[model samples]
Target: MDMDNFREMFLTEAAEHLQLMVDLLVQLDSDPQDQDGIDALFRGAHSIKGMAASMEYPETARLAHHLEDHLADCRQLGQISGVEIDWLLEAVDLLELLLGDIRNGRPERNVDSFIAGISKQPEAAVDCVAETKTVELTACGRGQLIQLQLQESVAIPGPRFLVLLKKLADLGTILESTPSTEDLLQGDAPNQLLVRL
Candidate 1:
């Protein structure tokens, strides 16, 4: 592998993802319940992880993976407070710094502090029993829920899923989505995504 070539491509892509992560973090800070924002944030971290690993940057990959895990936990618990958002933003900053070092031919920085900081935080217990819910719709709103299952073989489902969401939104107002737009954006959709419009 021509690492020089890969590094250039990685820098470009990683920079974009890092910027998106920061923007999503700011949005999440404003609305901690923003499932879409959380999903987008998670995707950014995930992309970084994948790219870093492919480029043989284990330290970068490890940190990105840890960040992705934290975001996943936040999504499951639905309890991302302002403090957590700030911590996430700081983590992003550290990632950006690490990427900068890589770009400048410096050695990978140690991310142990970041790992320790997040690990020290208390884990929120998820209410698995509360997952079930019922919704009552008016007579006029019947037939509004649409469930979509993406092809399992789709190379990258996130962008494709966004296209589907936009098409659905064009038809009518989206009342709800099962995996949520955020999850789709983050490429976390397992197989099916339900949309209510």
Candidate 2:
């Protein structure tokens, strides 16, 4: 099932979504009534949570879920307080830390303590609209950047991979690319391929 591939993809997407959450939260704090910003926040959080859960990254999933519900409350109540924004921003930062732990093979890192603390509050438990949402963030999306540090042993030829980038490009637009294959093809990037798709 390519679990390692899934883990890598999930980590990459989660990191981007977490950053989006922070940016959207900051925007929401300033206006406090931007429905579009709120919706974006919900989408980013829900997307990351779903991906994390599928990859068995429960800690990341739970944090995303927590952030989703918190934002949902603001949507329903029509206002967001300074304290609420602070908590939301802080939660995303913690999510970033936990995501680093997960990518490092340390999934046992204790994060439930922080999650449980947030889960105890009533406002954080606001009910979300029931819908069968399936639009998940992929390894490519705006503001969802990834630093691909390929292993040294990976072969350096188009044949090294069985031609997958064509399929990826078919799914979405390649927004930006660096360390061109010309560089990697000629061994100029030293396998430290950096891309933002």
Against the reference, the lDDT scores of all candidates come to 0.71, 0.59
Question: How many pairs collide in each candidate, listed in order?
Answer: 0, 0
User: Could you give candidate 2's per-residue lDDT for residues 76-130 as a string of tens digits?
Assistant: 8877764566556556656767777877888535667767877554353111112
Q: What is the lDDT of candidate 2?
A: 0.59
- Candidate 1 C-alpha error for residue 163, in Å: 31
By lDDT, the best candidate is: 1
Model 2 worst lDDT run, 10 consecutive residues: 125-134
After superposition, candidate 1 runs with Cα above 4 Å error: 122-197
**CA shift of 126, model 1, Å:** 27
Q: Where's the lowest-lDDT run of ten residues in candidate 1?
A: 124-133
Q: Report the backbone clash tally of model 2.
A: 0
By how many angstroms RMSD does model 2 differ from the true structure?
A: 16.8
